[model samples]
Target: MRLEKQQITAGFIKQKTIEKGAALCGIAPIERFINAPHGFHPTDILPQCRSVIVFASPFPISTLSCNTNSPYTFVRNKMVEKTDQISFLLAVELEQEGILAVPIPCAEPYDYWDESRNHGRGILSLKHSAHLAGLGNLGKNTLLVNRTYGNMIWLGAVLVSAELEGDSIDMETLCPSGCTLCLDKCPQHALDGKTIDQKLCREKSISCTPGGGWVLSCNICRKICPANRVIKQNL
Candidate 1:
């Protein structure tokens, strides 16, 4: 009966997340992320964490086609905001169901930062959590390449006390080997084969506040990725 209860809880959460604008949702056991940074682990946020519920919302590829910065910027912000709202709502619903839950933010760096290196890490790596939940895989560009949405997705997560059945890890590789478009197209050469030079990436991709909102200055890596193009074409 405990397993049945967990199953019902997970189903309810997934359905509610979709109704709240998530395009995809999945669950993973906390143990699946044992190798994550100590502070980013589910238990660190909520000591009773037993499962991780991850979700994603797709960004409209058509928005990038416009020359106006407003389209891409607006869609980007909307996607992240929607994902965050879904997670927060799910967390509240889980608590009402008698399960303790903690919602993770879709953006902002919180867990770790190295001042000398000028590098920051997220409290929970949403991309990796989404992958572990079987929503996507890491592409060569280091973005989470969702099977249906490619790299064009916003991710969020919630930690819960229910031990729900977790999704299986995706085994099929999504990136086309030998393709280095993202690396070659990077304006600052921030991408290496396996990792990004965070300092260079930030300098090229992020613009500081002028009036209020920050800007995503450059997006060549996302634009040039073949997988993203494929998704766009199919859509």
Candidate 2:
């Protein structure tokens, strides 16, 4: 009966997130995060967390083809904002149901920052959270590659104090064997298969216009990935 209740709660959470505009939703038990970085575990952010709810919204493929970086940057910013809002509302709704839920920020304002390496990490790594939720597998470029949406999605998550059933982890290899397009195409050589050199990536990928507007100046890794192109064909 307790297990049934957990399943029911999980179902409600997933359904509500989808209804709230999430393109996809999956849940992961806290036990699945045993390997998460010491200070970045779900329990670190919410000590009572027993499960994680991960969701995503697709990024506009049209913006990827834009000649200027403005469209891509604009869409990226909006996606972050929208995803964060969804997580926030989901948490509020769960709390009202007498369930403890904590929303993890989709981006920025994180406590971990390494100035020497120009590296930053969110309180909970949303990509890994999404992976553990069985939403997708991590690609060579270090992006979450969902089977349907590919890597063209923004992620958000909520930590819940409910031992809900977790979706099966996707063990399928999404990246084609011998594919090094992302690694070779990276202007900054920031990608090394399993990880990214944030310092190098940030220098070229992010820039400020003369007018002080921020721009996503580069995205060769994302653009050149074969997985990223799958969504276009499907559309």
Candidate 3:
């Protein structure tokens, strides 16, 4: 009976997430995060967390093709806000149902920052959480590549006290063999196949104009990625 309740709750959560404008959603049990970095676990954020709910909204493929970076940057910021909003609404709805739920910010406003390395960590790593939830596998560019959405998605997550049934982790390899387009194309040489050099990436990827407007000056890695372009062909 307890397991049945978990199943029902999991289904409800996923359905609600999709209804809330997410393109995909999945659940991962706390056990799957056993190796999560210390202090970054679901339970670390919400002591009673028994499940992690991960969801994503597709990035506008059209924005990526624009000549100027402003369109891409504008949409990128909006996606984060939209995903975070979905997580917030989902948490509130779950809490009303007597379940304790905590929303993890999709990005920014994080406490961890290493000035020396120019690195910052989200309270919970949404990409890793999404991978554990079986939404997709991490690609060579360190981006989550979904079977349907490819790498064109923004992630968000929520922690719940319910011990929901977890999704099966995706085992299929999504990256093409010997493809190093993202690595070779990076102007900053920030990617090393398995991880990114945050410091190097930031140096070229972000900038401020003379007028003081913020611009995501570079996206060659994401734009040049073959996997990142797949979604458009399918659409």
Candidate 4:
């Protein structure tokens, strides 16, 4: 925790993140962390803390292809496990450095009867936080789309007692140009110009997903986008 200009080094973890298969990483103050989607509704004042470290690990493109048609829970659990493992390791490393850390994708399961069950959905929003935290911008499909990963990434963060002055960068994401194709491609019309309706999207996909796959909805948005498709062809 050196203190000079910016309280933390922006590129330190950024370098490690690449080797660890992280597509992107960034740091923000605990105050800003609480204000993020991961924090859900933040407290009036952030408690004694330093910064929030964010990381994004790319999910396998094939993982997105699998469906309930497989009739096995192994793949589903594997996806969740891999994501939580990445987040857990980051938190552990922070603790080893004598920092108080909280990992996203918390190990706790939400209770169906508990009112706060809805609150736990903020984990999904953590993807949005990581996106704005310099990982990438939210594509039209509402998934965080990176140059290397298209709607195929997991996000996690750590809260520490170290703040980096001037490290808080502006979340200025450049929207893809003339990319309303995803919006128009939505069969359920869940994506409007401003906000998305998850309920409608999920319901509409039920027809395509048999034996209980529609609960999560389809990703036609990413499949139709030209961003990564162009990169793939060039490669």
Candidate 5:
């Protein structure tokens, strides 16, 4: 029956995501997702997107270092590759069993907070969505704060046609509301509590590169959050 299989799909998805390296996973309605502004606007997406299956892959803590910018700096982009691969794999598995699975692409890749656009698409505030999906809370650095998983998690979501119950997480209830360790660790001062001055962040970030205040990323805030202190997964 469709009903029985719908429930089975969740278990399959969970198994596949973890098998493919997900550290945590949850589901939410597409309606709950669009309101998030961290990366991009999902407002126009159809209601056919009945369920959103969210997942996170863990990042390494011990391997982090200044000289390790090659890996840490490219963490987001790299996570995209891994997430995309696993997503499609799940989709294929789901489809074979007559369950619908659609992998939603990650946010557009770009210098999201570019001064010219005044509209940052990629850096949408997705931590709350993550929390609402039961992934985690926002950390001191303003990143998703998973108590056991730490700050070392990359996110992905599946917009499925299959109707499923949405999960909710109380972020405020989980995290210590006023911690600022993430801010203290930020070298670029990108984070000042929950509000980030992107101009200041970009300006300081670019200074490290060869070009004058403009080049590849300098993910200082994301890389140093204390939530990563107990990270059990690597890369």
Candidate 6:
């Protein structure tokens, strides 16, 4: 596609995302993630990838504090399902426009993890993708903290073969100066200032289904962060 035509198509994709229930949407050229770790790049998933469409579906902030057994669990689960539906629909829409697009799921891994690590690593880190897409900045807690939705948001992505313009990164830092709330709040101390111990976090936060129901066992890091204070004030 021509440069101008690609831009118009990108615009249409973004609009379609919002119309389909996403609260935020932006584009990220595959070049922006050239240095992404092995097996995590758009090209790694789809070799012909030229652009990435990342979008966010915000959830109620109140539900961040809910226990696994609480009613908010249902709401959170529904949001996750809704995000998948939106991404799938967008991919179909793009295909109808004669653009090849592949939707990256919001939850659930494409395959099993290495037994030694047992970490929950998706093909792409949605938070990092969201940052690159200019939807938000990454917080110290490893969550994408959008100015409006804070860290209480789910992200989805789509890879496209058509060339499209990417959004500039948001350089603004959402973490407060000298704040260690998230690190301190972590029950397993899974987060250091520079990185997160995903194995520890996953083990502590995720509950296996014995019967068959969703259970996010913990979210202390997300709940204690000051990044969401702006959203709180607005409410």
Candidate 1 TM-score, C-alpha based: 0.91
lDDT for each residue of candidate 4 in 1-235, tens digit (9 for 90 to 100)? 5334333355655564555556667665545544453335222123554666677665445434455424223343555676577667766765665555566663245322224322225432555555545566676666666666655556666555555432445354434666688789898798875467756764654344455443444656655766555345544
Worst 10 residues of 6 by lDDT: 1-10
How far residue 162's Cα lies from its native spot in candidate 1, in Å, is 0.3
In model 1, what are the clashing residue pairs, if there are any?
none
- TM-score result, candidate 4: 0.70
Ranking by TM-score: 2, 3, 1, 6, 5, 4
Displacement of residue 184 (Cα, Å) in model 1 is 1.4
Whose TM-score is greatest here? 2
Kindly report which residue stretches of model 3 are placed more than 4 angstroms away from their true locations once superposed.
1-8
lDDT of 1 by residue, 1-235 (tens): 2234445566777887898888899998988998887687878788898999999887888876776566687788887788778888888877877788899988875568897777888888888888899997887678998778888888899988988888888867788877888888888888886788888888877775667877777788887777776677776
- Per-model TM-score, in order, reads 0.91, 0.96, 0.95, 0.70, 0.74, 0.90
Q: How many pairs of residues in model 3 come into backbone collision? A: 0
C-alpha lDDT score of every prediction, in listed order: 0.82, 0.90, 0.88, 0.55, 0.63, 0.82
Instruction: List the candidate 4 regions with Cα displacement exceeding 4 Å.
Output: 1-21, 31-46, 62-77, 106-120, 165-174, 205-217
Tell me which of candidates 2 and 6 scores higher on TM-score. Answer: 2
- What candidate 5 gets wrong by more than 4 Å, as runs, is 1-8, 31-43, 66-68, 74-76, 110-119, 123-126, 173-178, 184-188, 206-217, 232-235
After superposition on all CA atoms, how large is the RMSD of candidate 2?
A: 2.4
Regions more than 4 Å wrong, model 2 = 1-8
Instruction: Using lDDT as the measure, name the better of candidate 2 and candidate 4.
Output: 2
**lDDT for residue 170 in candidate 5, whole number 0-100:** 51
